[model samples]
Target: MKLYTIDTGFFKLDGGAMFGVVPKSIWQRTNPADERNLCTWATRLLLIEDGKRLTLVDTGLGDKQDDKFFGHYFRHGDATLDNSLAQHGFHRDDITDVILTHLHFDHCGGAVIREGERLLPAFKNARFWSNEKHWNWALHPNPREKASFLKENILPIEESGQLAFLKEGDLFSPNVAMRYAYGHTESMMLPQISYKGKTILYMADLLPSVGHIPLPYVMSYDVRPLTTMEERQSYWQEIVDKEYILFLEHDPVHACCTLKQTDKGIRVAETFALENI
Candidate 1:
């Protein structure tokens, strides 16, 4: 099996909201904010190549939204979904599967593209994978999360007849398993992959960056902050005990990291590119 880091570029989010209850004084140390108090975050994705099946873990925000809509997020950077795929000698049409961690815009917006007046699946050849629980949650989004779950980003896969659901105990690939975390969003799926004699856990919104390693650094966007804390507490310990390499999606500087049981708590032990693994 082969793996590649797919960087779809960076966008800004309010640092205060990203850090939740954590003071800006602390989070700013790792993810420094701009004049607007918005922190730059990478919409980094993962590509799993196992034989003929080319699976893309998540698609970053696509270029379909209007300028007024995009003005809010301030999406910047040279990396793009198409350009990133081409760098790996692949294309969107080559993807056989697309594992959507959840239907949040930043995570799944690129799953569909706007052609003229029609919104359609971006990866026409791929089967978009999402869990049933999260699918329902995104469809009937709560007021707080409605903005993040854009109907244009979703619904198209189902409409295209390419949507698939991963059930509990189901293996996405020969070496990948689906794990669920509910705090960030309902039934957010994290893909656990066994590669090169190491285990890599894709850290979706559950753990955005190294700065969020500390127990209390949960995100305000999370519907259930307390549940997020509990989930992180458990996942961190296991990650440390088993020495799992975490594939960070939103961390701008670090693509992957390992956790160590330090005197302070489970903290980032090391950070490096996925290719180094």
Candidate 2:
């Protein structure tokens, strides 16, 4: 089995929104913001290749949205989903399974595309993976998260007759396991893969960046802030105890990090590229 980091691109988000109650003076040290108060974030995805079955963990924001819609987030980067896939000698059609952690626009938007007059699955032959709870939640999102669950980016996966809900003990491969986290969104699935004699967790918003290692550094977008703290505390300890390598999705600077329990608290023990492992 082999793994690769597919960097879709980068975008900017409000520093406050990304850091939640954490003040700019503190967060800006790790994730510095621009004069506009927006910080750069990477739309990083993970790809797993075990023989012929190629699974893509999460897709970044696609380019279907009009200029007016995209202007809000300021998506700017040299790498795209297609280009990134090709960089590692693959293509959209080669993907056999797509594991969408949640239906948030930034995470799953690139799964569908805009055809002349229709919205269609970008990976025409792949089965799109999402949990039943999260699917229904996205379909009828609350007013607070409605903006994040865009219909054009979703809906089409089911319309394409290729959407599959994860079952009990869901396994993308023999070595990759699906773990659930609810603090960020309903039934969000984080892929825990056993690679290179180590367990790597693909942190999909549960832990966006290295700066979020602190328990209180939750994002404002999380539906349940208190729940997020509790979840983080539990996993933070387990991650350190098990010495899991965390593959960060939105961290603009770092690709992966290991944790250390120090007197100050849990902090990054090491940071390096996935290939280095």
Candidate 2 lDDT by residue in tens digits, 161-252: 99999864878678988988888888889999999899999999999999999999999999988998898889889999999999999999
How well does candidate 1 match the true structure in TM-score terms? 0.99
TM-score for all models, in order of appearance: 0.99, 0.98
Error of 1 at 213 (Å): 0.5
lDDT, candidate 1, 170-263, per-residue tens: 9988899999998999999999999999999999999998889999999999999999999999999999999999999999999999999988
On a 0 to 1 TM-score scale, where does candidate 2 land against the true structure?
0.98
Q: Quick one: RMSD of model 1?
A: 0.6
Off by over 4 Å in 1: none
